[model samples]
Target: MSDIEIRPARFESPEVQKVVAEALADLSQRYGGSGDDTPVTMSDFDPPDGAFFVAVRDGTLVGSGGWRRHGSDAELKRMFTTPAARGLGVARRMLATIEESARVAGCGRMILETGYLQPEAIALYESAGYRRIADFGHYAGEDGVRSYARDL
Candidate 1:
């Protein structure tokens, strides 16, 4: 949409928290994730570090994605697109945007952990050149999350 804008979400910003919570709530509903965990949780990309972003269309946000460097590799977190905004290339654009950020930040590679329940998410990553990789970060311990990676 012409009004759609992709911008960084200030880590502690209220709007960022709202959108992220809504998105995670959606994911939790779809999968069995209780999502009781706070949506505003931290990572390498929060506030003093890391990055977050959102895609707003016609005043309503439709998608978001963010990444943070871990050693030399960038770890992507909080990537989500609302169903109402899917099939319009939103996810692909967000992925490219964040990957661009990674490249610009001097990262050599990028990695992410998605889930089996999210076929669309996995497909989007694969389409954007991310290949299946070992589970990473928060997903490292959980048996649920499936991870993927790609060179910048």
Candidate 2:
């Protein structure tokens, strides 16, 4: 935990972009093509309050997530964790970081879109005060995946 450094990542960094691309590639294969025709790039996801972040340990970025303001809501997106980082509370920490960002941005509620293919993600969200919510923002009904939201 002490080695973990959660900080903003730029879409310009090839390393960061590579991690994100790989995750999206997996998503693309899982959901019958890429999730978005014009996927949100890392640059499109960077942070002051609303931005993308990577949780680094030593020197490796092990986890990533982003929060974007969607009108009155802050939508969490692109949350991913490296396999090596699994079982280490990285996802929970990343979610907490995202929630902090949303709170700091003055957003009252946070929502997310996830897939059934990711059972671990479902459990994580459910345990973190999120509940089944109608698809919110752009990812609603695009597929039959589970969507959720939590009030901050």
Candidate 3:
């Protein structure tokens, strides 16, 4: 298999938006909302506090993920792999990029919110050493939402 390459990306860039839109569309089908109601903006992924990234393999955008500072933790966001790229380690590579960037930026831990509907994502996180944590941020107290965290 060709290596997956990950690179920094502007959240507002069309390429990033295209992948993000695909992720949101997939989430919408499973979770019922478009995820547009959240406060995640381009500015949230700006330098010093956050970073966004895209993953490509064999010239195709395969996955995307990012980390935004939330107190002492880096909150993971937009983590998704294209349907065609699933099980190819695209998401795992993107996640490693996010975690390394977050650690470099002084974050001590990584956190994320996923839903019960996304068993694959939950399994991935669990396999990566993430453990259940209390609901956080916009997911706090929201039914069906689950949070996970791990030391970086």
Of the candidates shown, which would achieve the greatest TM-score relative to the real structure? 3
Residue 149 local lDDT, model 2: 90
The alpha-carbon RMSD values of the candidates against the true structure, listed in the order shown, are: 2.5, 2.1, 1.2
lDDT tens per residue, model 2, 33-59: 764453464445555447778889989
User: What would the per-residue lDDT of candidate 1 be over residues 114-140, giving only the tens digit for each residue?
Assistant: 777788888888888889887766557
Task: Write one digit per residue (lDDT tens) for candidate 3, span 1-152.
Answer: 35878899898898889999999999888877785356797888998999999888888788898989999999999998999888888888888889999999999999999989999999999999999998988868988988999999
lDDT of 2: 0.79
RMSD of 3: 1.2
User: What clash count goes with each model?
Assistant: 1, 2, 0
Positional deviation of residue 69's Cα in model 3 after best superposition, in angstroms? 0.6
Which 10 successive residues of model 2 have the least lDDT summed? 35-44
Q: What is the TM-score of each candidate against the true structure?
A: 0.86, 0.87, 0.95
**Candidate 3 colliding pairs, count:** 0
CA lDDT, every model vs. true structure: 0.77, 0.79, 0.89
Score residue 105 of candidate 1 by CA lDDT.
81
Error of 1 at 12 (Å): 1.7
